[model samples]
Target: MVSLRLRLGKAGRRWLLLFHRWAGIVAGLFFALWIGSGLVMLYVPFPTLTETERLARLTPIAWDQVAVAPDDALRAGGAVGLPAAFNLEMRGGEAVYRIAGRDGNRATVSARTGARLGPLTPEGALRLATEGLPDGRVEPVERDQWTVTARYDPLRPFLKVALGDPAGTELYVSQVTGEIALDTTQFERAWNWVGAVTHWIYLTPLRARPELWRTILLWLSGFAALGALSGLVVGIWRLRLRRRYAGGSVTPYRGIARWHHLFGLAGGIGLSTFIVSGWISMNPYRWFSSNAAPAEIRAAYAGAPPPLGLDAATLRGFAEPGTRGLRFVAIGGSWWIVTDGLAGTQGRRAADGLPLTVDAITSAAARAVPGGALRAVEPLAGFDTYWYPHGADPRPLPVLRLRFDDPAAIWLHVDPRDGAILQRLDLSGRINRWLFDGAHRLDLPGLTGSRRLHDAAQWILNLLAAGIAVTGLVAGWRRLRRTLSA
Candidate 1:
């Protein structure tokens, strides 16, 4: 009886051990890739260039000094290697033109002086994306209601251009005098396509065709998750096998395998969380609402007073107490004040003094809520809590500027006008919103630290995933060869 029991136990242990080893070897590589890609995406900057950088590329020509026509400028500067669809924006002092091409090379030129500003050089852009704005960051200059002036290099000639949502607007500013020209047309349409690409992976028709890439990623991620789980099971099985067959003798390779199993187990959980959140974020119709009601409710809870149609100037005054370093204001039916708060701080607030049903008519001391409040409801639904600006720009919009508070905490939104509670959304909630919005943006302890950690993890995982795939193929090949030989 005892001998029979021992034999059965030994067989079970061998089976479990084989399962664990195969599972680990199979899933290790993919698990690493998903995590690595996620980390790379965390810090990658959006495609939009800073105002200063954009303007700097164009050698400033005197407003009175008009040298060439659009065609002449292109001819003088040499053939523009861009798509035919790119348009031109020329005024008294400045002339700017952009062209898109097949190779993802976009060129921006200063047409006034016929100077080759630069090809929004992909390499340079990528560098800027990796290494973000400098440390002693000044407040972003506000342009229009939805536009903010981002300075690339403060010491050099600053570029004061306006952007609305994530789209580029036609900003007419004096090239020589650096004065605001005519706010004729906002370049919302221009950036619409660009923003769409950045916001959703489905920007290009090719990308959207059968939603191939996304679908592939989904399946890949799913497989990766399965592989990881299987790996854990296999690893556990292997331990039992070792105990039964080897009589507690452990090989060095087995130890190494064991370590891999442990790390994979933990990393697997993190990767799974990210994947699930990311998938949920991609499906907005089923998850989020676009209209302003949910936003309003969230704002009200945050203590923001109702909106009142106040002119930009009045709104500025009402907001001055809470917002220092006021820059510019945009007054339409609703007023949006662009203020330069402390360095590295940026935010937005909306208010309506009248009742919910009444149209906001006055810019009086009505309560207002910051934009961040609307972002905090995402994570509870099992999504990551990073904020992603959905409509246009690929970058996460900063609707409220708060210093590095607890990343996990959601600060109270006060009405800039009345200091009332506007709304409250936690960091997790914001992360969830971002997950739906299609990006992972976590403001970690420090830029350097975060980037280093993310980059290192990515590098490790990608290599491992690639290695695993290769090894698995080799192993299968060897097994087939042996079987044939036998």
Candidate 2:
């Protein structure tokens, strides 16, 4: 039995070593790229237009010129029912109502003429893109690296206009809707080649095909994770801690090999965790639920839409001193006009045009989870485990959190500022949050609480990972050359 056990152990170790070595040779470059690009991504995230930035860029609503009411615009736009989202904003110097129906139908109606609007021409798109800027050039693009993702498909065929500013900013204006879909500065574009582009494998050709990209990422990361696990096992098995190796050294290998072992021991677990979490980010096999509030949940929260007796005059009255735009939304079976202003987002009871209090928002949140018992409604004055801030994506604070006692254990984070469902985290969502966000982003208590600490810890761990990858790459290359020679 002892002889058999010894033979089996030797065979298992040999197979493990062979697998780790060949896998390293195959995926060393990918590991190196992931580690290096992750460092760059620490500072430079992918480009996104935040709500604050969007509000600031928008030309304030020309309310007086808005002759068509919300109801009138909905009718003229051929909307079947109450719109899922209805907002009035200035589009190419015209007051337009962007109405999105529950059934995924979207239409733009001219507030001035009550006429259905069509997609913007190149000139109109350029005009909208470079409203107050000194334009240098305008070029139409079907797709580019920055705007290549599927999220921008609905707003395809953008007009890229370079603003002759100090920042060398470029704006991608959606020809479909005349909206500034994305903006990239010279610095962002230059660094993103090494940062987000490399990190996400976000080349336009591959990413344009969503399924292909996802499949590739899953395969790559999955293999990389296996390699990491094998390396970790070999690292532990080879490490002689108490009984030490020759010359009192814990590691037998010298120079780069020695360093690889050491660094692997230090960072192998973390690297494995990160790679696995990154794979989870793709939501393979649909193990996690979407964070977005479902349409039914949103409808239940909004309740039956009361007749929005809003006319041009009433909407104009809803505008405050620096109100940029007005959104007609539903809350607690009633309608409310939400104003995006220079001060911030504010909501008013549409029936009386009175300011909404906290109680009104809380009451609406209670109905968000259909058929579930409302357990508790707590106020999140700051960021929490599942509601922490994300880079370039702002999470509103002072939110009202509603916990439901259901099988799914739903938790809704409501933005009291405008009565919007900011996030919906259920059981799978919370678990995914930890698996993806917590493990991948290191969004733990200490790390995220302090920027300096987070950066320092990331730098250390990434450097360790880099050391392991670099040494493995070198060793793998030499091994390949030797094998070929043999």
Q: Using lDDT as the measure, which candidate wins? A: 2
TM-score of 2: 0.96
lDDT of 2 by residue, 1-486 (tens): 999999999999999999999999999999999988988998999988777878888878877679987888888888886678888888867888888778766688899999998877777766777767765578999988998877777677788889888888888887666778788899999899999999999999999899999999999999988999999999999999899988999999997888889999999988888888888898889889999999888987888876787778867888888777889888888889999976888899989978877788778777778778778888989887777776666688898888998889999888887889888999999998889888888888877778888889888888888989999999999899999999
**Which whole-number lDDT from 0 to 100 does residue 448 have in model 1?**
26
lDDT of the candidates, in the order given:
0.37, 0.86
C-alpha root-mean-square deviation, candidate 1: 15.3
lDDT of 1 by residue, 138-230 (tens): 122323322222221211222333333233233333222232222222343334333333334433343434446557556655554555455
Candidate 1 CA-lDDT value: 0.37
The candidate scoring highest on TM-score is 2
TM-score of 1: 0.39
After superposing candidate 2, which stretches have Cα over 4 Å from the reference? Answer: 132-134
Q: What lDDT, from 0 to 1, does candidate 2 have?
A: 0.86
